[model samples]
Target: MQDDLGFDRLLDDDGFVARLLGRTRSGRQRKPLYGPDLPVVFLVGGPGMGKGRLLGCVRHDFGRFVPTAHLDCGAPAVTERVAQRPELRSEVTEALREMALQFGKWQGTGGALPAPRLYAGLLAVATSDRRSSTESLVSEVREQDGLLPPGTFWRGVLSRAVRGYLAALGGLVATPAAVPIISAVLDELLARMSREGTAALKRCYGEYPGAGGSPELGLHTLAAHFQQGGQGRENAEKFLFRALREDIEAAHTSVTGRMTRVGRPALLLDRADNTLGRRLTRAVLEDRERGHHDRLVVLATARREDGGRFLHPPGHADEGRAATWQPADGGLPTWSRSPVGDPGLASPGRGALLVRMPLLTRDQQEREIARTQGSVGTGAGGQGLPVGPGFPGSGPSRLRVETGIRRLSGGRPLFVSRLAEATAAFRMPEEGSDWDLLDAPAGTRDEQEEHAVADVLLDDLVVRQLPEELPPEQREHWLDLLSHLSVAHDADCAQALMRERQAEREERLSAYRIAELLRDCGWPHCPRHFIGDLGLRHLLARRLYGTRAGGAAWREDHTFLRDRLAGEEEGAPDALFGTAAAHRMHHHLAADGAGNGHGAPGAEAVTNYLARTFYTRETRDWCGELLAIADVPLLGGPDDRRARALGAGGTRGGAFHRRVDKLLHVVWLCEDRARTVDDAVTSTLRLLLERLSDESEHGAEVLTRVAGEWSERAGNKQALLPCACTGHIR
Candidate 1:
């Protein structure tokens, strides 16, 4: 499907294996040692950061020479084991039965299947049986082979079947009984399989002999064996270690094929800090130390705190110069200085290199868009037909694609690729087309383009990272936070809002726990508060604000803005003030033009109110002084009655004076705004005073002067201001 997205190809081009192997090109084949002594290398990043893709590439490229295995550490088998308790027994029994059947089937098939295919079939059979018991099914398989005495063969069949069942269960549950039983059986079975099966299993687990098993496989050997396969316990472990040793030997071996005893494998662990628990980190370190191949090299990826935890000698490292291996000398590498850093550490070696993935330049993005669209059009046309009309033709200068890449991707490659895919699918028209640009007609080509891009991205790119099947309370929390953050334009403000939401969620969680405890003790539980993460809160908020069903009710019921206002003292003032001002501006603009007769006074009043309510005394005074000096057009022409009603009596003079007094007070209160405020306030006040100077003068000198001043202030000296005082203003 779509050439399997070519992930492997991308990784190959990116030199992932070469980097991992710690090799550089100086016209010599130099490979780093990889053995029991070396630390394990972990590639970590967010989902779709190409960790899995790089692993795939490594396997594909070195499957023959190095014997690589790739397994998803985050697989459900490892993560969901604790939740599968009730079904554990049944699951184990079913697994054994299926594996017995598979053994029989393999025998019947002459045992000639490819290792990968055989293992795949076996795994599939075991997984299927876990859903439904395969006792009868195994019998059927035997019967098909013309094997008689179902009773006589059933015992061994059942035992083998049980072993298989334990193997399946072992992957999911690390248990005393299951691990030993499954491990023993697997050891026997693996001894019987061809070399290919062994190799395949090795690749599947990413374990080599001297290299040891993945720490994700856990502490126990039996447990690891069962996790790997049901019938290959000892051999699996041996194969894993052997593969590691072989790879290390290969790396250190001279071109003449002689082994050179060098330092241990240079382990490059990336983002090891993200492991869910300390147990995992400990297990990985223990596994490496236990092997003791020679000259161990352990490289781990982690944030500073996480790395610090491991820098201390592991609890299990009791033997051989433990005192010498101090925390500081634990062979930690720092890569913070380099752009890409060493995926292995925070810093780089002298010959070490970093290749930070760069954001696509505007020109690069445009070219890519054009190339993608042109290719798609050409593919659709068949043969040598010209590509779509959107593709630029020969000209003095090539057309520039004006779409904002930063707006679309935030400089993330995954986001960029996703947006590019969406844009390509919709075939968005080239910029500056004759069609209306700002607002596209509903269901038109442009609308389809927008929808297509948003839909694909939201579904394929954004939604995958979310927790599985969010609960109602969690959903609500997510939505509320997202709504608040979405309105923030400043990056700092957005990040702060997110952090605040996270803190609030933690408090809510604590309250939820207290309520739950109360409920258990026959006390009334509060329904208002619950616990969850910020992501959950954001998700719920998004649904509430954007959806039709519960969205309206939720918005109306929740007083999030009021709550935020109450906590304004704890918030960043700049952000809070800006948000409050914007909200007020929006409300004023939306008020049906009914307030203060002419609406202008109402709008101006709202601005003044924001300056008073949200801003500090200094900011408020400065803003007030500026507004007071700003000119107010005189009542005239068709709207004269409305304007006159608004400016009734000494109300206009009072409003102007009151505003000026407020500005003066602000200037007096804040030393920072005093001198500047006078200049700003005086200019505006002078313009308004000029407007009401005289009738004849107002028509010519007053209006003309104001127009010239307004244009100059607006940085558009030739542009006319739309004056409500004019007859044609309405």
Candidate 2:
């Protein structure tokens, strides 16, 4: 977070807090900030809108007030571990372990340890065998009431807790009136520790509490009494749990009061929804129901979608106050609150205020653009802005560059930041100075020109952000992975795609590094399955995939990704068809429409593909894109005028007849099934009809027959007007 990567941060702590806890959300009334609510706030934003950066800003500002416990909860391995094992110890305990250790190591001996590395894996001090030891402690703590303070680095906690409890309970346990037995046991154990050593004392703890010689032995013997199936084990366990919890809480409170003189301490959850969702939910509920976190302000960050659980725990309903997670009191509380939910969508869940981030304003845009310009060409695998003293250094040139970036980035801070970074990265794929790419205005710029710039930016950022710096030969595989991501449709499939190629790498691209690439490329947020920014994927698709030669190679690549996904889906074809239906349809048409080699077989494939799309419910979602690309003979678009020229230049023959037949089948499908025909589709159909109807007697005859069949099968759902095929065929 304290990196010297050069870009200036946009969100300021004080101002961001004002905006975050702002009075109005998109201009609607929200619940007023209240004392009863846990200081848990969800800072919500979409991809590249500075959500990640917002977390960084909070750490800078809020860490002083709240001795921050920072965890990059979305690290791929961390997320995987939770999804697999999901024990509370693994999620929150281990995280607290990391923070305590990170801060502890930072506070080592003399000076504070260096700020914890950003996006570093979750474990901090707990490494190698420590991982196993911590996990075991977590399980033991969960099942048994542990009085062992989780604070391993904080010296004297166990000593102090044991001593205090023994002081209160020693006489009672001595004659043992009502002495806090657990504390007395810890004291006895601590006393033995000066002579016997910690390991031997701890070993003595597992022995019989009734066989107590020392307080540690007394506590453990008591524990063993309950554990060995006696009556008061539950009460004993609960007391010990409370003791442990209080000790941990006191340790945290001790640190908190000393951290800052600010109003209250805050907890900054940096995208822990996927990993710590269940734990945070419980913590907040405990704080709410039991008034545990009343003194702390817990500010958690997450993608807008995950604000639901952050706002309220699961099984919670009836305002944000009630827990269906327990039992619904039916109909609900009049004092119910709608704290958490998508404010923009007005879907309130638990009663937490939602502050959804808006796109950058003009002033903010200019500030970012200026920052971009300064950072560029720093020789940092970055794209430097413009240098021309004539055009861009002046008024109109600056305006054009600002306008192009704004147009490309849509004022989303992340996109703009990366665009600046890419510009500074120094390798311009296009021929012009950065001027044309950055200068083109919204309407004045060529679509193709804007597209090329986006692809270059995507490539630049992907490479620059990639872990383990890819070499040239493996770069192709890396590019292929990027391409595959554009079409993978979701995070799991994308990960699987990476795993598929992970085995291919021996020298580099290990399995963990491949997964870590997700966070490296600014995907620390949830909903990772879908590309955080769709425009990035679209640009990658259009650039890496081309329309030359029917875009056959492009379709081949799409099909290649699709086939691999399908194979992975194995018996669950629905897994491929249901989730990524749009992607599959796009690829299927692209590949099936590669009607070059097979004559009748190709024609049948096209017909079958069209028929299924016409009848299926899933096809409705992507029919618009299908029609847009399917107009040409292959998956190529209207921009491929050269292909149009070649197709129209032909003399009609039997082979040509089949080609025309394949092309006309789309029109026939359109006539029978399309609810609407776009001007582009109609125009392309007209040109095809006009050309083929006059080609030769046989070509005309074949065209007439297909047109007749389509006209006969035409239904009410057909476009308001028939394709020109009807008029030309006769």
Candidate 3:
């Protein structure tokens, strides 16, 4: 059986269970004088942190002593009921009927069934109520009863009957008058289960063919005919207590029966925060408190907020009081000596013992990979290599597993599972993997494999596990903000964007919308508020930059809008000049100097435009490149005819002088292509002055001093021209 259930074997390690149990027990010591009360332990963690695995461990190690019934609050039945609010009349009826049938089958077998038939019955009832098809229900029940006998059809029958009983019980509880009666019945059942053996209770609840009167009295008839005298409500209560006692005794029979008063059953509830509402949590907590008996414990798993739901309500004060194990300064408390007080017990870190589930260490991850892979093959391997071609190996290696973990899981369990699943399904190789092994492309086939894994583990399993009523908007909003934040360096900026979108009246961005976006974009929520990784940042940047509008036709039509406007404004001087300048700049930047080509005309036009507009130093950088290509002087000589014709009214000369100096400064400062600011400035200035008029002795010393000062300021060599005063002809 263990071999058939290979996955189950991995979870049967007692060490993990002991640690969990120890944490639960370390809190408040039970006082023997007052009698032992059931310990309510709540297990909490994010999705995929092993809550389910740990619960399985608990069931395996302490099933007999605890008689725990695991309930998944996120189950479809619970979620559907919470969501739609429809009365589960037929559903509940079918469930109870199924339970009764299963119970009967187990009894017929003398409780020799491999697994607990009663649990199987409960599951069947729950399954039936969930609107599962008859074939599906049968299949599920049969699957659960793997090695059980075929004639155990009575198990199905008894399971149905028990379902009916529970439905009736539910109906009775709905009424104000029968609430206490139902509560007492439940209390009695729990107590009796602790007293008598489960098999004995099954027999007492079993059908009596000749019994008459009310269905409740059928139990009395069964006891009278089968067990002789143990009947009626009082006897039923006693029988329930006896059954519970017997079950506990079977598990811990080594202990003296008299000392059993202090041993209580432990009820562990995992992910209780997923309750449809506070009402369910309160109801469960209250039931445990009212139904408290010696050695009976109720340990529930939930987020701290879920635990508070039970406490905040007025009626459940006592239940809240019982949940006194809270996280404290330094660490969790080993014992709570204080008395149970008002319902205001939930404070920050003041509810349950917070057993944090840390991320699996690298060593642990490697071991898990080795173990998982080893099961597939043979021999102790070093590690699984990364998947892909030319990964330094013919096949997968340990590095592949490590890379997969880093890429997929980011060392998170949930992520690891997701990444593993993705990598398992990943097939296509990214471009250039053969070229550069380290540069694995993201959002590629391999990346998608990683994302798909996260989708399954984190999105499907973890996020979906929340309660149905957890406001779809909130979820969407969280996902949307998370998606943006995960790729942004500034978390505050992402948050601002979310706030802005949310505040817009026309279309408020919903949480669902955000979640959908994140899913679509393959973005994951990072633990850090902002993302800092350059690779991820680049990916996000690409996504943002690559956003194109519609088809190529649409883009062409949009581009034509400007062209149409240009044709309509043919007479506009500003339009003509701007267009000409743009065309000239384009030509200058692209063309070679020969007049035979389009480049020379464009360069000449740009240089002329720069001279006419009196382009600034910054503009000169562009003009300089154009002038160089055009083979034109930026500044004319003083005695040159063009300079005389232009008029040196100090306006043109001063402007040209300022422009030349600024251009020099820019050349000196430019980082591209290696010229330092000083080098560029000196070179361009020297070239300009070489064409300067030799006769214009006006302020020659000033020009030389200016060039020298500028060069010194630029931290490069002095200009080669040595100013016009030197009389050195080019």
Candidate 4:
């Protein structure tokens, strides 16, 4: 069942997949290639945003074309390989060894990237003690030799190393055969390098306060210190990483003849922000800093945009920035690079390219929906027509269903795919609209055919990604906590919500902690917003509002926020025109507005707030505030509840009510811009301009300008697509 939810299982998007691989639609490689050419490319996105899925696609689609090996940094298989040793550095070595094995097994254009130097260094660390036998060391080296592609490079380097070690020993070893093969090889290489060549390794360990100045002892110290972490541990890790890259360079040179027709070997690191992964990435950056170049491209997945700060320094300008996959002339997604400086270098700036994992554009999503519907066919005794609104394959019905999906998914592939699958299996009545299907009763006798898709989506997108360290009960508590906090606008508001729930005790659930968890799980980080992704936030918010306490939890939560803000406003009266005021009115309307023929909440207060702030803030700023407050996703959709309540002019019959209503009507129109542009909405917009004109005639031109700005900012009418996923890269 879980395998069926695979992104490629339901959609045929090979063109997009090829684009991700830096290939043309016809699967030809792009020159000046960004995918395999770049030393590091980060695929950044939130959980269920398809970062892992993209990696899967790369392996499945392009494995034969490129010499690719994938290692999940978070997978226990990697760390478990060296459980007896139990060191992060050892885990990194194991990871590299696994990659080397994979590269050797591939029958592709790029041959194996043999890491003899790395293997020798690790072997030395394993057998540096006098009690260890030469036979064990020989066996270890021979074992690694078998995994590498057939080459004389290891034997030649090891033979030279053995000769050097014997000469240095000078009868200290009574028997020549007693000397360890790998340790001798590593020692010889360290000595063979020029002073400048070895200086970087020495400097890395120089900061470490540990003893052992010799190269063999240094290797031992580095691997040992990996357990006792600090600057010393990091330096040790970097030293080993540098050795790995050096080996890779030599290996690349050796394999150059075979790799002419292929791109560089790819190391796909999934969940690269994990402990072992971070070390590998940081080492690559440091290697690049020292002007070390290798034909090894690292394609890593990062939960954060700055590659979890390993790719770039803190306070980086492009932090949390995301862009659409705008394919260049080469037919690959255009990427942005931020140069990260290494302080160790005199001229220190090696950049990492950040490539956001692409979300499906609305057109692609609609196509996928249509495709799934066609494949699933009509249920029970119906013809093989697509199942949806109007007549089975009617345009209006398709459009309506697509619009609902856009609202629910915001173009997230997982959400869209699951929803499409569910829609295909369920047969709706001729009179029922897409909304009925989406907001169908969870436990009705007739609709008893389970909402399996929604459940799976919720689990995969939210619950399943939570930390496994959490007790089963605590996981539920945390989910509920996140659901309630999803309504929070920023860190402060989220922290406030946490405090109100008194949930900061056992789990230490705070804004920063939650942010960290969200990031680790591959969710976007909107510093200004909690649960950054809109679709995700809405999903959790839906759970909060619809499921718990029979819908009372929604009002109760909003009312708590309203009362909390009201208290804050009492102490700081001046904050009424600030963020606090906008948030307060947001909670006010969400909590009090029934939208069931009842009057809007605090209509007079809302009117006063808008009237006072309209002139002070810029037109765009005012509209932004209005949208922030008005764009609440109520159970009945954005329109029926919040929009209708705000648009309704209650008994405050005067210029104030009319003026506020006109402005709010503009907000609703923009929020629902994807829907059919009806005459009533258009007429309401014109009424706003006229009302603004009346104000301007009285020498108050601000309102008229504000209305125009709002309309223009909503985007031109004809260009407005069904939802926010309008940026299609075709």
* Top lDDT model: 4
- Candidate 2 per-residue lDDT, tens place, 1-730, comes to 1221211222322233423332221222223334445334555554455555666765664444333445665555555544654422244444444544444332211212221110011111111122233334223323321212243432332345335433544344336233333333344435533432343323333332353444344444444434343344433333332222233244344454335222333345665445354355444543354333344445655553335433444454534532221001222113333445432222223434344545565555555656656522212233445553322242433444454455456566756665554443333322222233532222213455443355555544464344333556676576556654554544555655566645566644543454444443334322422333434544455544553465554665556655754543322333323334434444455455433322323334433443344334332222332343232223333222223223443323555454444354445335321023234444455445445457444445554554444333332224322232121111
Better of 3 and 4 by TM-score: 4
Off by over 4 Å in 4: 1-38, 84-89, 109-114, 128-248, 255-262, 314-349, 375-391, 425-455, 464-477, 503-507, 512-529, 568-582, 598-629, 636-677, 688-730
True lDDT of residue 465, candidate 1: 39
Q: After superposition, which runs of candidate 1 have C-alpha atoms over 4 Å from their true positions?
A: 1-16, 22-30, 33-44, 47-50, 56-65, 75-282, 289-367, 375-402, 425-452, 467-545, 549-606, 610-616, 619-730
lDDT of each: 0.32, 0.40, 0.34, 0.56
The window of 10 residues in a row where model 1 has the poorest summed lDDT is 433-442
User: Which scores higher on TM-score, 1 or 3?
Assistant: 1
Candidate 2: list runs displaced more than 4 Å.
1-32, 45-49, 62-69, 74-91, 97-185, 188-260, 290-293, 308-351, 361-367, 374-412, 424-533, 539-553, 557-627, 630-730
Model 4 C-alpha lDDT per residue in residues 487-548, reported as the tens digit of each score: 77667677878877865466556766776766667666554457766566766766777766
In TM-score terms, which candidate is top?
4
Candidate 2 global TM-score: 0.45
The root-mean-square deviation over C-alpha atoms between each candidate and the true structure, in angstroms, is 15.8, 14.9, 18.8, 8.3
Give per-residue CA lDDT, model 1, range 1-730, as digits (tens): 1221323222332233333343322112334433233334433233233333444444444332322323333344434532443222122222222223322232211121112222222232222223333332233222222211133222333345445544544443443333333233344444544454445444544343333643213223423443455443434333333333333343344342234232223322233333332233344344433442422233333322113233443432222111111111223232211132222332112111122223344434444444554543212223334546555442211221123222334333444454444344242243221111111212223443544333343343334433222344564453344344333323443444455556745433222332232222111111211211111222233443445553443333233332343444422334322344333332232221123443344334544543354233343332333333221111111222123222322223344443433332222212111011223333343344334233233144533554345435333211122221111111
